[model samples]
Target: MTPVVELSGVHWGPKRQADILHDLTFSVAAGEVLAICGANGAGKSSLLRLLYRHQAPRKGTVRLMGRDLWLMKAPEAARIVAAVLQEQPTDFALTTRQIVALGRLPHRKGFGPGTLDNAVVEAALRRMDLTAFADRPFGTLSGGERQRVMVARALAQEPQVIVLDEPTNHLDIRHQLELLALLRGLGLTVITTLHDLTLAADFADRVLVLHQGRIIADAPPSQALTEATIARAFNVTARVDRSGPAPRFSFQLHG
Candidate 1:
């Protein structure tokens, strides 16, 4: 089967700065959930930007559905991939419903939103369990609530691929699990940065570990998240207990 997202020899950095990411190569199969794991400044978010077109690579190519991502027009790419980054419109006075309706912009023809667009937005709201908060002002919601609104907006785009950067950052434990569960059922190519090793193991089909902008491990969670890899990438001693149905990681500083 053809991969949905592919990156080859990709390198990126702010102009004149050393590359934030090195020659990275990987491919995510259709309907796979990929979790990017790394410490702070490990370039997880920069890698995601390549996938979603927030920034093009300084070298190599990022391909979506077998075509070069940069070759496509903005709206054309938006129709395939949706991104929920840390940036939020907290100052915007738009309601929750209005926030999600913005996802339809790539599909919208004229000015007014159409019946199909409204239906898509409504479905996205319902899917994210934001129906009750639909009419509420976006700025009034809590951090977790706002995060869900962003995900709802991404869903409203009806994207084939969804990229989220630190998606569980603001959620409480219960909501984090709930949102991850919801992602598993989306039937889309899901890529997200996750700090929680346990959650990353449980939520993703594969795990990609980055350190100093280089991919050290890219494989199934079972293989990608071993004791040595975790310790090497994170600079901490780690052990995995696999006696249970799932792999559990315990960490400690190297003495």
Candidate 2:
């Protein structure tokens, strides 16, 4: 099967400063969840930005659905890839439903609601379990609720690929697990940056470990998250337990 997303020899950053991503290359298959793992300043978010065309690579290409991502027009690309990044306060004024309905803007022909758009918005709200809070102000919802509303908005876009940056950040364990499970069930091409190695192992079909703007490991979680690689990339000693369905890591700061 053809890959849904591909990056080859991608490099990006200020002309004078060190590149945020350097010679990074990887691909994600259709319906696969690929988790990007790294320490702070590891270029995980930069890679996502390249994929979604938020920032262009200084060198190399990012392809979505076999076409160059940068060459595609914004709305054309929006129709294919939807993203959920850190929410801003500016979004808080919109109600949960309104926030989600905004996803339909990419598909909207003119400045008026249609039956199909309304149905899609309602379905996305229901899918994200935001129906109960649909009319509530986005600022009033809890962090987990707000996160789901963001996902609902992404879903409303009807995207073929989804990209999330540190999606599980700040959520309690329950909400984190719930959100991961929901992503798994969607069966979409998912690319997300995850700070938690354990969650990445449990949720991602594959894991890519980045260090110093380079891909240090790219494989299934068990291989990519080995203790040695963890130590090398994260400067930590770890006990990697792969006896269960998913690998687990226990870490100690290395001297």
Candidate 3:
């Protein structure tokens, strides 16, 4: 089967022509969940931006499905890959429903919203359990609620691949698990950047560890979260155990 997303020797950075992602190559298969974990400045967010075409690579190429990302128009690319970026400001005074409805812009022919578009937006809001808050201003919602609304907006886009940056940032433990479970149920290609190693282990089919802008480890969480790999990339000693439904990790503080 053809992979849904593929990056070949991709290199990108904002300035100085220094490659934050150095010849990074990876492919995400359809219906698979791949979590990216790394320390600060490890270039995880930069990688996501490159994949979603928010920024073009300085070298190499990024492909969505079989099409070259650079060749695709911005609206066309948005239709194929939906993203939930970290701490994106909602300075606009839009309602939750209005915010979610904007996801259909890629499919809209003119400035007006259509019935089919509104139906998809409503459905997405309901799916994310935000139906009651549909009419409320987006700025009024709590952080976790706002995060769910953001995910709902992404869902409304009906994209084949979802790229999330720190999706669980403001979510409570229960909501965090729920959101991951929901993503797994969708069975779309998922690429998420997560700081929580234990959550990554529980939710991801595979984990990719980045260090200093290079992919240091790519394997199942059981193998990827080994003491050595965790220590090397995160600079923290972790104890991995298979006692639960999935492998879990506990960090050991070091001086």
Candidate 4:
């Protein structure tokens, strides 16, 4: 089967700047959950931007379901890929339900939402447990509530692939587990950047580690997140114990 998301020889950066991600080549299988882990400024978010088509790669190609991402129309891409990024809507005046309803905008047949669209929005609201806050202003939500709202919005898109940048940010431990579990059962391609190695290991089918501007390891959590790889990627001594249900990592400064 064709890969859900693929990048061959991809190098990316803003115009006139050095590429921040270099020579990336990989494919994400349909319904697979992949996690990206790296230290600060390891180009994790930069890589996600390319996958979501928020920014085109400076070189090479990005393909979605066997088609060039740049060649697809905006609506066509929107129907296939949804993203929840750190950046948010400038207009916080919109209420929670309204914000999530925006996801259905790409699916509407006419000027506004129809019955099915409204139903989908309602389902997404409930799935994210945002029903109680549906009438609240988006800006009034706490950081974690806002994050869940954004995920709900993405779920409302009903895309084949979902891209989340630092998805666990601001979420409490229970919510974090709930959210990752939910993603696991979604049956869509999931690509996310995660700060928590244990969460990534437990929730993802594979883990990709990035360094200054390139991928260093792309493998199962057990192999990709070894003590050696962690030390190299994060510049700290790491002790990874993988004997349990999930990999646990301990870090120490390199002397």
Structural similarity to truth (TM-score) of each candidate: 0.98, 0.96, 0.96, 0.98
lDDT of each prediction vs. the true structure? Answer: 0.95, 0.89, 0.90, 0.93
**Candidate 1 clashing pairs, residues 3+ apart or interchain:** none
lDDT by residue for model 3 (60-94), tens: 88999888999999999999899998765565578
lDDT (tens digit, per residue) of candidate 4 on 35-97:
999999999999998988789988899999999999998888999999999988877899999
- Colliding residue pairs in candidate 3: none
Give the C-alpha lDDT of model 4: 0.93
lDDT of 1 at 67: 96
Off by more than 4 A, model 2: none
Q: After superposition, how far is residue 166 of candidate 3 from its true place, in Å?
A: 0.8
TM-score of 3: 0.96
Pairwise TM-score winner, candidates 1 and 2: 1
Q: Which regions of candidate 1 deviate over 4 angstroms?
A: none
lDDT of 1: 0.95
Candidate 2 residue lDDT tens string, 5-24: 99999999966787788998
RMSD of each: 0.9, 1.4, 1.3, 0.9
Which 10 successive residues of model 2 have the least lDDT summed?
85-94
Instruction: Give lDDT for model 3.
Output: 0.90
Candidate 4: stretches off by over 4 Å: none
Candidate 3 deviant stretches above 4 angstroms: 253-255
